[model samples]
Target chain A: MKKNKSDLIRYLFFLSAILSIALIILISFFLFKEGTVIFKEVGFLNFILGKDWSPTNTPSSFGILPMILGSLYITLIAILIGGPVGIITAVFLVYYTKDKHYRFLKSIINLMAGIPSIIYGFFGMVVLVPAVRYLFPSNGNSILTAGILLSIMILPTVINLSEVAIRAVPRFYYEGALALGSSKERSIFKVVLPAAKSGVISSLILGIGRAVGETMAVVMVAGNQPRMPKGIFKGARTLTTNIVMEMSYASGVHRNALIGTAVVLFMIILIINLVFTIFKERNVNG
Target chain B: MSKIKIKDFNLFYDNFQGLKNINMNIEENKITAFIGPSGCGKSSLLKSINRMNDLVDSCVTNGNIYFDDKDIMKTDVTQLRKEIGMVFQNPNPFPMSIYNNIAYGPRTHGIKSKEELDKIVESSLRKAALYDEVKDSIHKSALKLSGGQQQRLCIARALAIEPEVLLLDEPTSALDPISTLKIEELLQSLKDDYTIVIVTHNMQQALRISDNTGFFLNGELIEFNETDKLFTFPENEKTENYITGRFG
Candidate 1:
């Protein structure tokens, strides 16, 4: 009877693992099927690298370079603003804060992450957009606003991941460093951070992925003018926002073209995830 | 002489007292070992010197600890720590290359030239008796070395910083018999320059290596005596029972 029960438990775990893989495969298959139809009609190369993106008109062109460039621009801004702050916050929490305060601060960060994405977008629309307008009054619904809002949206993720990474480094590392007559900052930078390199990189990558895939918030604040952002204050559209904005009004070739944009967005995320995995693996082996 | 003086020291972990009023003096250029069963505050006393106990969330200390006549509690902890090096029970090498592991300390102290750092790294490794084995591959990841080699490398790292005092918490507790002997020899040689204070569980190690030994039991210093006398003629019954394996 005990043997049978143990066998059942093992089978259940095995089934769960198989189910997860199957779910990923299923999602990939549907995405590819929906995505490839557009690529087949329009050459994949042209769909990827073309410059113009007017879906409604006759001379209809869906060169998505502007959207890609816009996404890259906003993501870079968010990283610049958010990455250092997140890492510093994590360091403060791990190395400096007392236990009670650490827990309190940690809970606040967790609550920030738990707040709904749309709620953050709504908050950005209400608060940050106007704040940006006030600061840069000449440019309304600009890329700068989108970047700042997205940086706020992803701050919790960066902080949470960085905290976990820093905390995961064994206590022995700190003790060893201290014993060797290293100052707390020296130990953190020279020993702790280096050991947690993989975790830090993954956190940054996760932040980038979050910034890249963000649509609703960017749309609300970005002024969605389907152009490459020339300045931080200039309005722009990203791949996800372009898809969301056009999908309802799009029909036939236009629909396919919009879906093709989704496919491109999907590929970009895939490439990001691939690079993340490759970097992690290289660090492990290297 | 760079002696460590602890006068009327007591320690507390939050509300619970961990160590009682203790007075001890560790002489310069000598290997002093603290021995006791677990939870007896052997490690606590070692940490007090470098102010490592300050990092503990609820830890608090009372009384004065002096190294080289400077009141440790009042001294700049960062500067004090930089002068007194420590090695833990387990060998922990940073995830960097062996060269960087030794050079990290000197670099932090503002030795920036690569050529100068290379020389420092070589000399430190030689002092730790690890140079010959790892000289060719100092750039390799330190994590790849064996447990014993890692421990020695940690010692080299501490030595590289040129600390006046070396506090070792069971430096050979994790090593094999051969490695332990090698470390004992290394410690003996190191006594010419460093004020060595070690905490050990192995009575044999304390007997073999230390110039002075302090036997602690249940947060009290039961006896502090010359190494030879402590082994042969302990004044306290508890110390005698402990050395004779009556009960720990």
Candidate 2:
């Protein structure tokens, strides 16, 4: 009787694994089916190259160049501002900070990670957007404001990933460097940082992805105009914001265009993940 | 006489005393081996010289440690560490090309030019006797090397900084007989330039490589003398007993 029960449990486990694979395959098929329409109707080149993005206008232009530019702009700013600070904070937590404070700070960072994305956006909206508008009214509802807000939204991800990466470095690596008479900072930058390069890079890529896809929070603060950003203090819209703003009340061509935007975002995320996987594999094999 | 001096140095880890009121002097440019049973605090005493114990958060120390006429505790730690290098019981090479592993220390101390780094790496590896075997593949990852070569690479890394003192905490404990012999031979050659202090559990190693030796028992320095004299005629009965396979 016991043997039969054990066999049943084993078969159930196998069934769950098969079901998980089936679900992923189904999702991929759906994405391909929706995205294939673009190749047939608009052609990939026109969809990618055409810059006009006024879908609700009389003629209904649907080029995504502006939104793509906005996405790139916001992602770039977030990475530029967040990358160094995140890495340094992680290094401090792992290598330099006193042990008594480690646990307390680590838990606070963990809490930041656990908080919902919407909450971060709300905080950014209520606090940062208004503050920027008050201080620099001429730059109100600008790309700079959105970028700064998104940097905060993604700070937890960068800091958490970087901390884990730095901590994951084998204790012996630090000891070995110290034993060689290298200063702590030198060891961190030269040895620990290089060894954790893949992890740090992945963290940066993750932050970029989050910034690119961020919708509701960015919408509330980024002055969503679906136009190319002129500078740090200009309004903009990303592929994600374009979809969220129009998807609820769209029909026919407009819906397809928004779905097309989603497909592009999906591809961007896919490429980032693929690059990370390749680098990590190379690091392991070497 | 005071090449490395410790006066009433007591070390503790989280309220547990690791070494109690330890006092000793290590001569200059000589090989001093510390031997004892497990947990006798030999390694603790060796680590105190360079303040490596500071890496441990709960490690608290009382009393003085002086090296070369300066109290090491009060010196700039980074400068002090640059002058005093260390090796461990287990070999740990940086996860990089073998050449980079040797070049890391000198490069950190402002040796920027590639040609200069390359020369230092080569000389350090040759000194550790690992250059010839790896000359063709210096750019290859160090993790691919054998255990003995990795240990030697670590030694070469320490040597690249040109430290005055080299502290080894059972450096050969993780190696086989042949590798251990190679390291002992390397130590003999190295003692000409650097003051070497080794902590080992092996009585044979102390007798073989060290000029002077100290024996510890329960955090206490039982005896300190020249290796030959200590082995042939120990001043303390405990030292004689510990050396001759008596109670540890």
Candidate 3:
């Protein structure tokens, strides 16, 4: 009887593993089934590189080139601003912060991560949009504004992950450098940071994933125009924003095209994850 | 002449005494070994010379350490540390090409010229007796080297900075007998150019390499004497017990 019970438990564990794989298969199955219809009507190249996205027009052109460019540009700006700041902040937290203060600051950053997306969206709409408008003399809604907001939103992930990576470096490296008459700053920057390079890079990749997938806040601050991205000061629309903006009212081929936008977004995130996995594997092997 | 003078030095870590009142003078360009059981404060005194104990937040000390005539506390910490290099029990080579690891210290001291760095790298590696072995793979990641090679690489790295005193805390405890012998030989050669202080638990290592040896028990220096006399002659019962392997 005990053996049978243990076997049942073993089977149950196997069931959980299969269950997760099944869930992923189900999700991809639905996405491809619904999203592939637009490809047949619009053709893969036209749908992907299409410039015009007037889904409500007579013939309804569904080119997503502008949204693609917008997503890439906005994500680029976020990383450009957030990457160095997050990494530097993590180094500071690891080397400088007092024990009690470090705990407080780390938890506060964790709280920031736990904050809902709508709050960020609301904050960006009310405060950041106005600030950018005052500074740039635009409608206050543009790729630059959205990128800045996304950068703020992604800070917690980048800082927390980078901090973990930096702390994982052995202390003797720092000590050995100091003993060599290298200053504390030099030791941390030269020896320690390089040792933690893989971790830092993966942190930035995760931040990129979050930035590219961000929708509500980008839609609020990015001026959500369904055209190709222009200058930094001009408005833009992203893949995620396009899907979220019209998914509710969209029907038939238009709705399917929105799902196609989701399919593309999923691919980008999967690629980022694969790159992150490669970095992690390399670190382990070395 | 003495290279470093310590007078009435005491170290405490959060109310726990690490090193009780200590006084010693290390001779110039000679190897001085501190031998004791674990937690007896030999490593603490070695770290004190370079002000490395400053990294320990709870650790506090009130003492005077003099490098030649100048007080180390009054000297610029960065400048002081540059003159006093250290190596630890475990070999810690930075995860970079061997050339970059050796160049790190000189670059920090503002040696930016490529030719100058190349010259320093070669000379330092040669001094540590590592240049010939690593010549072909100088651009390879330092982490790829064997245990003894890594330790030698660390020594080469320390030499690159052109420090006056080299402090090693149980530098060979983690190595095999052969690697240990190689490092002991390297230190013998190193002493002619730089003042050397080593904290060791190995009594034979002290007898073999050190000119002067200090024996510690609990938190105090039990006896300080010439290596031969300290091992051969009768002085403190504790030193005798430790050397005879009766107790540590």
TM-score of each predicted structure versus truth: 0.94, 0.94, 0.98
How far does residue B134 in candidate 3 sit from its true spot (Å)?
Answer: 1.3
Please give the lDDT score at residue B224 for candidate 1.
97
Itemize residue pairs with steric clashes in candidate 1: A50-A63, A51-A63
Error of 2 at B230 (Å): 1.2
Ranking of candidates on lDDT, top first: 3, 1, 2
Output DockQ, candidate 3: 0.83
Per-model C-alpha lDDT, please? 0.88, 0.85, 0.92
In model 3, how large is the Cα lDDT of residue A223? Answer: 91
Q: Give the i-RMS of model 2 in Å.
A: 1.3
lDDT of 3 by residue, A59-164 (tens): 7899999999999999999999999999999999999999899999989889989998889989999998999999988988999999999998999989998998
Worst 10 residues of 3 chain B by lDDT: B77-86
Write model 1 residue lDDT over A1-286, tens digit each, in one string.
Answer: 9999999999999999999999989977878888788788768878777777776668777778889899999999998888988988999998888878988998999898888778888888898888887877545688888888888888888898888888988889887777666778888988899888887887888899999999887888888888656788889889899989988888888888777787788888998888788766755564
Q: Rank the candidates by DockQ, best first.
A: 3, 2, 1
Q: Is candidate 2 or candidate 3 better by TM-score?
A: 3
**lDDT tens per residue, model 2, B183-244:** 99999999989999999989999999999999999888889999999999999999989899
Q: Give a tens-digit lDDT track for model 3, residues B1-248.
A: 89999999999999899999999999999999999999999999999999999899999998799998789989888898889888888999988899999999899899999999999999999999999999999999999999999999999998898989999989999999999999999999999999999999899999999999999888899999999999999399989999999977
